[model samples]
Target: MASDGASNNERLLAAARDDNEDLLLDVFDQPGTFDINYQDGLGNTALHYAVLHTSYDVLDHILSHEECDVDPTNKLDKATPLHLAVEKEDPEDREYFVENLLEAGANYTIRNKHGETAEDLVKPGDEVILALFRKAQADADANMDDIAYEDDDDVASEGSD
Candidate 1:
């Protein structure tokens, strides 16, 4: 039974590397296929392979899984999927990936082996992506402030009672 699970996971990893979106979806939809965060020999989850292969469709499928770890780091560089997305060859694709990852709750503060966060990976010339990063940071700050305010309000009301 254990070997069966291992083989199934291997097949899933192969599908990921080949950009086989259909097979990936098929396998993931089945029962007891593999852990959503399963790591291959190189410490990469299926999502990491999808990003490495530039398979946006597969990336979407993996991300759609409720248990998927958006911040997984591979063995080579301890780089998350967002790190790879930031370096995509096409500017539009790079921005799209970055935004999607952010919306999915990707942590921009997680650093890689080089001690660089996803925001630090943005190229100097990619103005659009840079702007998106700034916006994400600002939004995050605003959300945190809102939560803090709510907490304070709760405390004040309790004290007044």
Candidate 2:
């Protein structure tokens, strides 16, 4: 009856560009995929769409909502949001999302069953992306250092106990 407004594809595309969770929720909540490919091309639930879109709003919505599966991967590709974010173009923003996912236990080192790490997908010559990836790797490595130190400290403290 009313103008369909944007084409469904266009609407879905906008949901990514606009990066609004509330709006994306409405769009994805409908019958089919909000654009999650892991669940199947048409089956990639709303949460899956949010990651690829890199929409802060949509991402937040998905992360907070328990139903929004954070780990869905494309059947053939085996790409999780972390994998998507790693592969996606935005260096700074995508890296930020990676950090969040890692905190959530999203495996940063996970490969797509092809024996490739998230590090492999990054643009090799791109300075920004490479730098960001390097930083993340360093940070992950540092966390391990902290654990080692904590273990040493615990052993020392145990002497007093």
Candidate 3:
């Protein structure tokens, strides 16, 4: 069951690279196709792969699923999906994606095993990106009460004003 699950997850990730948003929706609509946060060999979820490849549609699909948390940390790196996106994307993109992730309930202030917060990964004083980062941070801090992911894999977030 475990390896089958793993192989299925690998397929899901490949679909993400192909930018097939429907694949995840299909999985979610099925009886029990995914563990939602399941990781493959390198501690990456379908979420991570989607972001790595900049599959915007797939990213949207995963974020829309109630069974997936926006802040799920990879087991080996203890890095959230947001963290991986920050590391992999360019600065402007990192800011926008991080804001979406935070508003979706990622704890933006949290660091990984490398002691690097998403904020730290960004270069200092890159104005356009910095503004968005600050906006995201402020939004995250203010909405702490409004953003939450339940232990049972439920995701609910604040209405952005």
Candidate 4:
């Protein structure tokens, strides 16, 4: 049973690495498939592999899954999916991947083993990528502020009651 699960997990990782959307879908349909956050020996998750090797479609499928973790850190560099996204060589691909990861709630503030956040990994002269990180940070901060206000309103209403 354990080996079966391991094999399924390996298949999941391979599907993501190979951009095999069909195989990924098949694996996800199976009973007792690996946890969405399952890490290999190197602590790399399907999310990490998807970011590194997949085009938008496979990555999108992984991100759209309810249990998919957008910010899993690997063992070697403790790098999250967002970290790998920033390292994509093509500027267009980098921006697209980073945007999707952010939209899926990848935290831009997470630091890797090297103490570098995804923002820190942005290639020099890539102001557009940097701007995306800043915008995500701003949006997150605004959401936090809104939550705080809502909490305060709830407290006030309870006191009034």
Candidate 5:
């Protein structure tokens, strides 16, 4: 049973690393067979592998999982997948991943061992990535305001009773 679990984790990690979406989806579909956040020897989860390997398809599948932790950190560096995505050499790929990650609710404020948040890692003059981060922050702030307003209304209604 231990071997099975270990092998399943290896298979899942390999699928992410190789960008084999079909294999990844197959493994994920089997209930309780594999954890979505299964970490490798270096404590890098499947999400981290997807980002490092530039496997957007694998990433999308992982992000769609209800239990997915978008900001999972690698054990060795404490670097979240978002932090790794920011380090992509290709600007277009980097921007795409950043946008998708934010949309998938990746925490922009999560700092790595180096104390660098995803926003902090942005290269200077990269206005596009910076704008995407700002938009996510604005959206998050708006959501908090809405929640607070709803709570206030609920309190007032209870008081009126």
Candidate 6:
């Protein structure tokens, strides 16, 4: 049973790395076949492999899954998927992955082993990526503000009661 689980996890990682959506879907269909966030020997989850290999479709599928965690850190570098996205060699690919990851709730504030956040890895003079980070931060702040306001309203209503 343990080996079966390990095999399933390897298949999951391979599906993500190879961008094999069919294989991924098949794995998902099998009950108890794999844990969506199962980390390999390197502590790298399927999400991490998708980011490193630029498997956009697989990445999207993983991100959209309810079981998926957007910010899992690998053991070696303690790097999250967002960290890998920022380090993409191609400019366009970098933007696409960064945007998708951010939209899927990736936290840019998460620090790796080196204490460097995803935003810190952004190339100098790359205002486009910086703007995306700023926007995500602003959106998060707004969400907090909204939650606080709602809580305040609840408190006021309770006082009146």
Best by lDDT: 6
Q: Write the per-residue lDDT of candidate 2 for residues 59-127, one digit (tens) a residue.
A: 665565444456666666676777777766766777777766655556566677686766688776766
lDDT of each: 0.82, 0.62, 0.68, 0.86, 0.87, 0.89
Model 1: per-residue Cα lDDT at residue 21 = 76
After TM-score superposition, the amount by which residue 134's alpha carbon in candidate 2 deviates from its true location, in angstroms, is: 0.9
Global Cα lDDT for candidate 2:
0.62
Candidate 4, residue 21: how far the Cα is off, in Å: 0.8
lDDT of 1 at 7: 62
Which pairs clash (backbone N, Cα, C closer than 3 Å) in model 5? none
Task: List TM-score per model, in order.
Answer: 0.85, 0.59, 0.72, 0.91, 0.93, 0.93
C-alpha lDDT (0 to 100) for residue 56 of candidate 4: 60
The segments of candidate 1 whose C-alpha lies over 4 angstroms from its true place after superposition are 1-6
True-vs-predicted CA distance for residue 64, candidate 5, Å: 0.3
Report the lDDT of model 6 for residue 66: 91
Residue range with the least summed lDDT across 10 consecutive positions in model 5: 1-10
Taking the tens digit of each residue's C-alpha lDDT, what string does model 6 give over 1-161?
12355577788898888988987887888858788999998999989989899887788788888988999999999999999999999988899999999999998989999999999999999888999999999999999999999999999999998
User: Is 3 or 6 the stronger prediction by TM-score?
Assistant: 6
- Compared with the true structure, model 5 gives a TM-score of 0.93
* Cα lDDT, model 6, residue 91: 89
Model 3 CA lDDT for position 60:
72
Per-model C-alpha RMSD: 3.2, 6.7, 8.3, 2.9, 2.7, 2.7
Q: Rank by lDDT, highest first.
A: 6, 5, 4, 1, 3, 2
Q: Lowest lDDT 10-mer window, candidate 6?
A: 1-10
TM-score, predicted candidate 4 vs. hidden true structure:
0.91
56-153 in candidate 3: lDDT tens per residue? Answer: 78777777777776776777778887777677547656665665676677667778888888777766665665565677777766666455434223
In candidate 4 the C-alpha lDDT for residue 86 amounts to 96
Better of 1 and 5 by lDDT: 5
Best by TM-score: 5
